[model samples]
Target chain A: MKKHNYSAGPCILPQEVFEKSAQAILNFNNSGLSILEISHRSKDFVAVMDEARALALELLGLEGKGYQALFLHGGASLEFLMIPYNLMKVEGKAAYLDTGTWANSAIKEAKHFGETVVVASSKAENYNHIPKGYVVPSDADYFHCTSNNTIFGTQMKEFPSLEIPMVCDMSSDIFSRTLDFSKFDLIYAGAQKNMGPAGTTLVVVKEEILGKSGRNIPNMLDYVQHIEKESMYNTPAVFPVYASLLTLQWLKNLGGIAAIEKVNEAKANLLYTEIDRNPLFKGAAVAEFRSNMNATFLLNDETHAPIFDKLWKEAGISGLPGHRSVGGYRASMYNALPLESVQVLVDVMKELESKI
Target chain B: MKKHNYSAGPCILPQEVFEKSAQAILNFNNSGLSILEISHRSKDFVAVMDEARALALELLGLEGKGYQALFLHGGASLEFLMIPYNLMKVEGKAAYLDTGTWANSAIKEAKHFGETVVVASSKAENYNHIPKGYVVPSDADYFHCTSNNTIFGTQMKEFPSLEIPMVCDMSSDIFSRTLDFSKFDLIYAGAQKNMGPAGTTLVVVKEEILGKSGRNIPNMLDYVQHIEKESMYNTPAVFPVYASLLTLQWLKNLGGIAAIEKVNEAKANLLYTEIDRNPLFKGAAVAEFRSNMNATFLLNDETHAPIFDKLWKEAGISGLPGHRSVGGYRASMYNALPLESVQVLVDVMKELESKI
Candidate 1:
């Protein structure tokens, strides 16, 4: 059976990345040693680290600048706390955009270290669109926002040009498109989406924003410690980093994010068009705020739900269920998720239409 | 040339474990799909999660017990801060032994939250041995100790029996030997040594010790939160956890930790005997408190150091350099390291001896 994967966070990965990373796992560069068995401080693995960091900088277009691209431990959830710990001073206030689950969680953690002001929030409308007209407080430390809402299926097409520095949680839609690097002071993403496996967290930070916050940050939770050590403070998740390296190489080979962005747009257009035009399916969010990465929708009737689920299962499709917070369907189209998979999903929708 | 990995952590893994994990990286279970491409919430991947947790409990002999084992996202480095955050209450103190770098760091983080007493310390002798306690503090919230010192190469042969609760940072030497679970209220280890890779931290905590800290613990850093969600509160390090699952399976097939302990003992004995008897090499730590996993030593003649390094590198042995604090050589003979590798190191020592 032809299988298509549509999971949200720990979604899909490219084939070449998997093949090469697997080979490295068994015998790294035919070095007669598994990649897992090598020391992180060794010259060979150091090269891997150097190249991965270099590529991340190149991809983000932050090279030759004072910014450091680091691969750190802990996922985006940990970053939810570390971001506030490193940025939010004791007496200062930080501006935040409360979009959905992850955004609100980051806000909650930020409240522990400093006062937080919701500059903008889509919560009033149940997070159906990217909330606009946020007033960035002049007295705030910085402004925080999530680039894409993974569960809510809303994206900020144009970032707010705030007077304060911008900090972004790009965990879901980091490498899917290109952006002006000069706008944001900091950006972070967990590796499960648009990167590689589920271990590493990539952080790209402008050096100027740190050390200003008057919080006594713990060493492990501090960004400056990782910045100084080049992210080798402790033993990192080597395999996941290596897998991410392979994924980056593949991305570069595909002509970088600009190239992939076109394909991604086409995929999103195909699926969203089918959902909007078809009677059996309706788009979940407002038309202006639909996510190019996650196309969410609801079936016309609940009676077709069971048969729809069975047909997809029979066809060997997986992770089509919506998040528990919202009971509908979400087809997550990460970078590694081939357009053919989206086509397969479009075909399923068409087939269902024919049956009716 | 065959490589012999003697890295203390992120060290040798079972050859089959590497192969199986590598296969999953490429085409998981021959599914024509990479494990990285799947959803962590999918049924197949959930089985991997459930089985890994199940096997962890089973391996620790805690399967149906009231205790719970969680796979945390950060390395054991995070536990340095998390331990204090989760345990230290207002007016409460935790007693800790200052043994080595990791132990001191744990103490450092603990002090930030509440009172911490360094009840015993081996710093007087430069961490050559674990400290012998004159007393365990009566009012301690918990007595914390590192089970093994990776840099100093010292293992605790026996833990102090205290009326107060006890927790251990068993980072380097977990699963390398048999542990009496009844004495511990909590145990945590980074999964880089004697397990799998270096992304996930395994935490086994007693339910009674939690919810008493009185600190506003962030959800990501909270052990209770992870326990409640079965470690799926966020997307975990899927590849590392999955790789670790295969390692536990390999351990079970080899008759669990007891069977591997014998092999580990034999390997350690062979290498330590070489260090003791050889005129060129001298053991640094006390013989009685030496670790079976990492045997730290130095050259009898400092002049012969360059030659010693060259010889070992020529022999394709890596990670033999001892820690800078204890400058010499450390041949870490982990559970997966074959006795044949130990013999090969012995042969190198003999060859060096003949030339000198």
Candidate 2:
């Protein structure tokens, strides 16, 4: 079966990235050492690290703008705590916009280190839309927000330009679109979604934003330490970083983020159009806030649920089942997800509607 | 040229493990989805997690005991801080045996959380031997030790049976030998040497030893939270864990820890015997404390340095250059390293001696 993977994370990657990564695993850069076994400090792997870091910055359009990119382990979840530990002051407060689960998780960790002010939240309506027009405090140490909500399929299209430093978790939607990279003091993403594999995290931080927290941050959690060491403070997630390098190279060869943004918008539109036109389905997030990366939807009637699921499964659609919390279907159309895959899902939806 | 990987780690892996891992990366379990793309929540990855956890405990002979095995990210460096964050109490003290660089790193982190006492150390001799006959303070929160020092090429041949909790960093020597598993409260190893890759860390913690720190441990660093969540407290290092599963399976098929220990010893002896016989080279660590996993040595004559380096490189030997801190050569022979590779190193050493 030709699987069209819609997994929110640990999700789809370009076929080229997969092929290259597999080849590297067998014999990394013809070094006769498996990528899985070669030392991170070795010339071949170091080149991978250097290239991955540079590409992450270059793709974000933040090259040489006093930003440093680090590829580290423990995923974006660790970043939730690390961002607060390294940025949130001991006695000061940081502002957060809670869009969904991941944003709230970041808030929960920030609260442990210092005071946290939830400037805005869409949680009241089960996070069906991105919260808007929230007052970010000028006095807060930093303002943090999640750019995309994976479960609810709501994305923050326009970021607020705040007086305080801006931090964002771009985990699910990073590289799916072009963004104003200069506005964020720090941007973190787990590589699983649009980047590469599930091990490494991409952290791009503006250099000046660190060393002001005044707390004794653990060396592992300190962004300054990691930045200074070029993400080799500890043995990094080498395989994932190498794989990420390949994916970033793929993204570059496919004409970078600008090119992918068009493809992403088209993929999202194809699925969203089917949901809107079909009588059996309803889009989950509000139209304005609908994510270009993740298009979540639901069956209009409970009776159609089983048939809808079976039809998609038979059509080789995987990971479309929405999170248990949301209780529907989520078609995550990341950057690498071709329009044809979304078309297949639309065809499945149309086929199910004909039965109805 | 065929490569002999003696990398301190990310190091050598079984060729079968590499082949299987590379195959899975391309098409996991014939599911038509790249392993890099499949959801970690999928049945395929879930089975991987389950089998990996089981195999780690089974190999350590801790199965069905109070020990809970967790595969996490951030390597042993993260464990340095996480160990203290979870085990060290605010007002209490922890006893440490400062064997080498990593042990000192762990001690450095522990001091931030609580009072840490270096019960014994061999820093005077540049960590060339493991400290002996040190009394562990009973009132300390825990007694921490490193089972193997990768940089210094020293291993703890004996562990103290202490009344207080025992925590060990077995980053370099894990799964290379059998041990009295119940003696330690926690055993953490970065899975680069003798395991799989440079990302995932294997943590086996006694269940009762947790939740006693009385500190607000970050969710990411809390072992209790990770154990409760079955190591999926967050998106784990999925690819590395999958690779580790294959390596563990390889170890089990080759008769587990006991079987590997004999092979490890033979490989160590083969290299050490050459270092002893070849007057051109001298062993770095004291004979009594020399690590069977990492055999550190130096050229008896500085004039032979360039020639010796060239000889090993030409023989396809990699990662034998000793750490800058301990200037010499380090031949790290992990579990997957065959005697043939060590023999090749021995041959290179002998050839270098003949030139002299």
Candidate 3:
């Protein structure tokens, strides 16, 4: 049976990337050394780091624009704290939009460093929609928002053009679509979603926005120090970074983010159309705020839940189970997820509907 | 052409561990999903985490001893700061022994959190010997030391029985030998030299020693929080942790630290004996403090450098070059390195001597 991976994170990567990464584990660049054992400072792994950083900026259309890209360990969860630690000052206030779990977590961490104002929140609606028409405080040092909510499957369609610097956590939706790169001062993503593996976090920061925090940032968490050391300030997540480099190469070869966004749109539209048209299920998020990356839905007839789950599982679907906080199905269609997998899911839904 | 890997970290792992890890990256547990794509919360990876933690504690003879083992990201460098952040209070002082590079780095980070006193240092000798007979201040919150200096090639053969808590950085020599586990309140090691890879760090902390800092530690850096979450406080360096698990399994199957220590001693003795007898080479560290993990040596005649280098290269040796701070050869014979590799290196030395 052909397995369809719809895992939320540490999720899906291109098959070629997996194969290449596996081969590298055996012998990296024919160095007769496993990628697992090679030094990050070695010329072979250095090229991997350089290419990964370059490709991230290139895909975001921010190359040579004073934006530095770094692949660091500790996932996005750590970034939640590191961002505020390095960017938020003791007296300054940063504005955050609480869309879902990750954004709320970010806001919580930012509060430890400085005053954090929740500019907008959709918590009242169980985070089923993206908040809009929120006011950004002029006194705020920066306006932070999560571009995509992986749990509730709500995505911000239009970002607010703020006078203050903008920081975005694009963990789930990064590189899945093309966005204006010049708008945000800092952007970070955990690589498990649209990128590669789970270990390394991708941080893209505008160099000019840093050094204004006026606080002593720890060396490992300091953006300026990491940039100065070229992300080799310490031994990075070498295997994950190398896997990310391969994925970026695949993305570049397929014509970068612009080209992938079309496929992503088609995949999301395919499943969402099924959810809307089929009487058995309904979309989790509002139609207007629906995420093209993570399409979440719930069955209309709760009694048929077991049947639907069995249908999908028999069809070789994996990681389609929704988060415990949101009890429903979530099909994460990352950059590596193919249209065929989405069709398989859509077909399973159609089969369940017809049987009913 | 067999390769003799002697790289200091991101260093050699057992060939079987490498093979299994590579296979898992392709299809983990026959689940039709790559280990790279599985969620940390998934049962498979959770098992990996649990087994790794259990095996670490079991090997250390600290199982059920009120200690916690965590596999975290950001390397030992991050732990350098985390140690102080979670242990050092605002007005409290911590005592340290400045042995070499990593220990000094740890001291530097400790100073950021609280008053750090260097109880002893061998900096005057360029760290060629481990300082002995230094009394740790009774007023100090804890006593910290580096068990082995990777760059300086010095190892502390005996640990001080301190009245206060003892913290040791065993990055280069962890699991390579058996030690009295109850003597230290905390031990941290980067998983590159003897353990596994470079990204993940191993932290074993006594539960009772935590919460003494009386400072608000950041969520990610807090030992209590991570312990509560079983080190899944973040997404973790999943790949590295999984690799570390496999390596731990390999170590356990080979009869754990006690068995490996014999092999390590033999390999170190084989190389050190050659370095002493071979006129072409001279050992760098004082014989009393010379490391069994990293054997640092220099050529007797600077003129023979090129020839000696060529001979080693021709014999398929890797990572034998010394750090720039100490201009000599450093053959790091971690647990994974077989005695055969040391014999090959010793043979290369003899060949160079014959040519001379």
lDDT of each: 0.86, 0.90, 0.90
TM-score of 3: 0.99
Give the runs in model 3 whose Cα sits over 4 Å from its true position.
none
Number of the candidate with higher lDDT, 1 or 3: 3
* Candidate that would win on DockQ: 2
Query: Which should have the higher DockQ, number 1 or number 3?
Result: 3
lDDT by residue for model 1 over A200-258, one digit each (tens)? 99999999999988877888998999889888978888888988998899999999999
Question: Candidate 2 residues B46-91, lDDT tens each?
Answer: 8899999988999999988989999998989898889888888878
Model 2, stretches more than 4 Å misplaced? none
Q: Worst lDDT window (10 residues) for model 2 chain B? A: B347-356
**What lDDT tens digits, residue by residue, belong to model 1 across residues B1-356?**
98888988788898998888887876777675678877777777889889888888788877666788888877988998898888877778889998888899898878777788998898888899987745878888888999888899888899988887899998788777888876888889999888788789888888888888888888888888888898898888998999888888999999998888899899988999999899998988888889998899989899988887888888888789998888888888887889988888899998889989
Query: Which lDDT tens digits does candidate 2 get at residues A136-160?
Result: 8889999999999999999999999
Q: Tell me which of candidates 2 and 3 scores higher on DockQ.
A: 2
Candidate 2 — which pairs collide? none
DockQ of predicted model 3 = 0.77
Off by over 4 Å in 1: A310-316
The TM-score, computed over Cα atoms with residue i paired to residue i, of candidate 1 is 0.97
| lDDT over C-alpha atoms for residue A10 of model 3 | 81
